[model samples]
Target: MKLQVAIDRVSLGYAVNLAEKLDSYVDIVEFGTSIVKDYGLIEIGHHRPAFKHAELLLDLKTFDEGPYEFEKGFDAQADILTVMGAAGADTLAGVHKVAQNRGGDLFIDLMETGTDKIAQISGFTDAIYGIHHSHDAVAGFDAVATVADFHEQFPNVKRISVAGGIDLPTAERLAKQGIAESVIVGSKIIKTADPVAAAKKFMEVIK
Candidate 1:
């Protein structure tokens, strides 16, 4: 299980600093949707903060105009980009093609999507299917249980990633469960007093 630390709701300068600090510690550093919406892709592309070790993921949460959004995200130098699972099949195909053509990865955000919808789009064998929980939801999430259920339902889907409010204990459990390819952590790692230490702790536990 890989550690993907998400940076969100912070200034671009601060996010860049955090990314630089965490580049070597984590496997992937994500610029959450807020970053893209607050500062457009053009700005991100121009800045192009260098990450020496970790890959960069832009959570575009693309709902439509897949080609345009994906092209811009890849141009901005994102190693991976996300599109909504609820998007139209054509839209999903568009972004998947862009990711393939650019030699990047596409993550389908499965927040609020049903099993039937997932089955319909499961043909994108190479894309990472992200079993995500909505950030705005009031309910809590059980990461392990969710991953188990998803795997049972869609056994053919080879790559799976999960994101919610994952803690160190949950991350460790996920690693042991051995289903999810990657686990995405946010405030638990980033909001702490010593983010590097927090991130390292997660890395240690997952290993």
Candidate 2:
């Protein structure tokens, strides 16, 4: 199990500082969509720490103009870029090709995509299919149960990841369930008083 720590809606300097501190603890450090859109690729890209220990997963959340966004993200040195599962198949293919060309992985975020849509996009073997809950949603999200159901619905998809409101205990449960390739955690870590400590604690759960 891999732990992905998200840095979102925070100042650039603070995000960099926190990321550097958390570098050794997490498997992947994710600059969530908010930061990417708020700070732009240049700012977010250059702030990347020299993480000899982890990969950088940038949630660009490319909904349209896939190629351009992926190019910018790759130019900023993102190890992985995300595309919305709700996007057109051609758009997904475009980003996937960009990712392949750049030697970065492509992640299709199944945030609002329906079951039929998921089945259609599940054929991308090199892409990660993310079962994500909405950050703007009012109700509680049960990521593990949702992921298990998604796995049952699309058994052929092997590279699965889950995100949205995940905590250390929840991460531990998800890891024990053994379905997701990686789990993404945001506010619980990024919003803490000591993000590095928070990252380490979450990493322990997955480990």
Candidate 3:
């Protein structure tokens, strides 16, 4: 299991500093949707977070104009970029090709996508299928159980990742379950008094 720390709702400089501090400890550092929206790709591209150890993921959430968006994201130094599963097949395919050509990874965000949609896109063997719950949803998420169910439904679709209010305990559970390739934690790691300590705690548990 790999720990992916998401930095959001803060100034880009602070996010970059936090990412640099946690780079050696975490596997991936994500600039969440808020940051991408608040700061356009052109600005983010110019000031890409310089992470030496951890991979950088920008939640571009490309719903349309897949190729253009992905091309810019890669140009902006994103190691992995996301596209919604609900996007058209052509859109997904276009971005997938861009990622492949750029030698980067594509993360398909399966937020609010049904089984039929998942089945349709499961053929993208190299893409990481992210089981994400909406941040605005009122319900709680059972990360392990959801992973197990997704695995059962699509056994051939490897490289699973999950994100939605994951705490240390839930991260440990997901690690033990051994289904998800990576678990994403946002506020639990970023909103704490000591973010590095909190991140280290999560890494220890997952390890």
Q: Any runs in candidate 3 off by more than 4 Å, and if so which?
A: none
lDDT at 4, model 3: 92
What lDDT does candidate 3 reach at residue 100? 100
Error of 2 at 57 (Å): 1.4
**lDDT (0 to 1) per candidate:** 0.94, 0.88, 0.95
Q: Would you list the clashing residue pairs of candidate 3?
A: none
List candidate 1 stretches off by more than 4 Å.
none
Please provide, for model 2 over 110-139, each residue's C-alpha lDDT reduced to its tens digit, 9 standing for 90 to 100. Answer: 988998898888999988999888998888
Sort the predicted structures by lDDT, highest score first.
3, 1, 2
Cα-lDDT of candidate 3: 0.95
Better of 1 and 2 by TM-score: 1
Give the Cα-based TM-score of candidate 2 against the true structure: 0.96
RMSD of every prediction: 0.7, 1.1, 0.7
How far is 160's C-alpha from truth in model 1 (Å)? 0.8
Clashing pairs in 1: none
* Model 1 lDDT per residue over 67-98, tens place: 99999999999999999999999999999999
